[model samples]
Target: MTPHDYLNIGAAVWLFVCWVGYARFARKRARTDHCLASVLHVYRKTWMIEMLSRQNRIADTALIASLERNVSFLASTSILIIAGFVTIMASIDKVYITITALPFANESMSPRQLQLKIVLLLMIYVYAFFTLTWAMRQYGFCSILLGAAPAHDADIGEAERRRYAISTAKIIDQAGHSYNYGLRAYYFSLAILPWFFNTWFFIVAVGVVVGVLYRREFHSTTLRALVRDLTATEAMKKSPNG
Candidate 1:
């Protein structure tokens, strides 16, 4: 293999490592840290438990439907993107010429190499489509779980009610996680766009993507506000007479 081929392999490896590594780090850190996922997980549990107190659950079901719609939209978009990639794969020569024509014209890689990059992007979107669809299905399951919950006035024990609510929330949490993975696919796919230019550009773009994801997930303004609100609510719940 040429040096450029080796660089391509190394860059691809770096992309996956950064992507997967950040996922693992976030998963572990979320157990103790205040990130979007953790904060949202807490809200999910609270929402599920609170839902048991309402005689009518129209609002709860509507909320689940909203989540399902969002996932469905992304899944549909992923299909369109995957189809675009497939079309591009069959016409790499034109793409190759277009890339090389640019002034900064990239690594002199052949059309075969460009096709490989496109295939990688296709695989990413395909994974995104599957994850998004799975998230939509999970949301559907959550709706059913809500429907099957014990009625508000049912004589269930407090412990049993809590147990059921927590378990149901776990389903929603899994759905949210699947949806997050789908989004991560979209983020990393942008990293591949720079690959058509050169491996160095590709590597740097991957880092940029990872950095952007890390900031939004852990340090964004929204996360701060959520954590603050949740903290205040928890404090209120523990106060005397609360």
Candidate 2:
């Protein structure tokens, strides 16, 4: 209704656009480029290849179990956070009073406005919960695939084994991607917190959050290292003896 309201809405839209747009861009680049996700994907494929060559797979199973446990823990945490948001929504009057008393918080938020803000937080956590649960399920599928994998001494052809390894590795990679999405939701939720203070602060928070994500995803030191490592590996493969 007001300029501040329009700015708040604009900030929210911008946050959503950045979140979804970056995810798509990263996914595309990860197929052939050197970034964190792409590097990790290469490792996943290598892990599967190693598993195919190993006679003992206990350690491999343990590693997959550990990944599943991590996803489960995050899913549980998201549920708890959603419940906390609901609690806050139920006691929004007290929350509004407390927040308005803070020196920097906007004092003009009506009950409806407060409720909307709380709902936004709740929705973000809900989305995170679903993403994490889906990741957990994918990890479960990975475990199943691992269990069904042919042993190193099996009579299966090498080509078949390699295919199985690549398929399983892709599944695991997807699970990791889903987990990353859930974590991104948590990051953006933090950006939404400043909206309760002022629209301008909310916009600034959105920019800061997106900037942080962009830098980490595309320009971090870790990415550079991965690129260098990948390049060296490719060079080695092209050598006469390789």
Candidate 3:
């Protein structure tokens, strides 16, 4: 087989593998009961109660820990995603996808088809680059929030303490959401770009992979589930009243 054919095969196989891994993780998590559920247990009323109860240290710790974990997850996933995009872009230049491999791909098309393929690829690259760049920015925000933490404070009600905690939590959550949105954008490219090679079926493959990933995250009965829940809660807090 040609290098191009091999690359297509590799992409398909790797995507399938990722899908399986995610599915398994989700299924396993869904079957357990764990503390991770607390992550999603956020209620503004509850937050206020914690604040009023003088348990500011506990609440603050939870918020900070959750933010750290979310940032870690995003950073790791962004690396994997950027790697995937780089591989695909490299393959686009080195390997020619076969018409037989992609039933929709026209091997003997006119110059216009080639031009369209070039344009489609450029679009994909542009989108992927932008999303990855945004992920990097969110990572930076996480770093900033981490640095802003008080060096030595064991109490709440100090004006700066309260303000810093609330502001930091909001910033971290916003950065986390941006990271997630950027990832979603990156995945959207995986689904959209293969069509240029007439392998739209790859889109289905990516969907399966993403669904598995999401299920593993939101359905996992452990800390992962908590992570997802807390993430959602954070998003809700940022949303305008409706």
Candidate 4:
């Protein structure tokens, strides 16, 4: 098989592994106690909302903890670099094949194509790495804040407690969005790289995958509920009681 073929196979296998991981996470969540399970359930649901609408709501402490755990995996950054290397190799190999099959020497290549490939690969890496690093830093900050949160029966002032809670929630929510953006970047990088092989097929395949992912994230019941909850909260905050 060609290098592109290998990459396509690798992508499929990675996707399957991710699916299994998600399934296991779901099962583990189901087996947890009601309170903890409910918290994670909502936290997971918020990501769906963010995926669909590119917006998220700050809800509970459990959500913050869960997002922190997920971000610590650094899945996006790792995947981006790994897949980007594979794509770069595939393009290079194809170029090698072109040179070898020609009538003349196989060593020479256009500077423009080489420069373009390097630029694209570096762009993907930089985008992935920057976001991943930021997410990791924010995760650490969230962890510190979570550790410092007051106990349920603490005698802290209501305003002070509320401020802490809101700030923590916002940090976690921002982390979730950052993680999502990183994942999107990784996928887009892989999808776009195939254009060097064949533009039309890569574009169509990428479009379909993107469309499916978007619909599942945004149109799901969980996301709709979260959206409603956020809207209601905003409305209440605008009122005098809030």
Best by TM-score: 1
lDDT per residue for candidate 3 within 1-242, as digits (tens), equals 56645555565565546645654654476456433222433332244334433533555546655655664565566566556645655655333544325666645433444444444544544554454455456556645554545644355566666566566545544554445544554564556455455444654657665875575456555656556766686689789971
lDDT (Cα, tens digit) per residue for candidate 2, span 57-118: 99999999999999899899999999998899889999889999888988777777888888
lDDT of each: 0.92, 0.88, 0.52, 0.56
Single out the weakest 10-residue window by summed lDDT for candidate 2.
3-12
What's the candidate order when arranged by decreasing TM-score?
A: 1, 2, 4, 3
- Candidate 3: C-alpha RMSD to true structure equals 11.6
After superposition on all C-alphas, the RMSD of every candidate to the true structure, in Å, is 1.2, 1.8, 11.6, 13.3
Point out where model 2 deviates above 4 Å. Answer: 234-242
Return the candidate ranking by lDDT, descending. Answer: 1, 2, 4, 3
| Tens-place lDDT digits, model 1, residues 3-117 | 7788889998999999999999999988888999999989999998999998999999999999999999999999999899888878888888888888776758788888888
Which number leads on lDDT?
Answer: 1
Residue pairs in clash, model 2:
none
Q: Itemize residue pairs with steric clashes in candidate 1.
A: none
Assess every candidate by TM-score: 0.96, 0.93, 0.44, 0.53
Question: Where's the lowest-lDDT run of ten residues in candidate 4?
Answer: 48-57
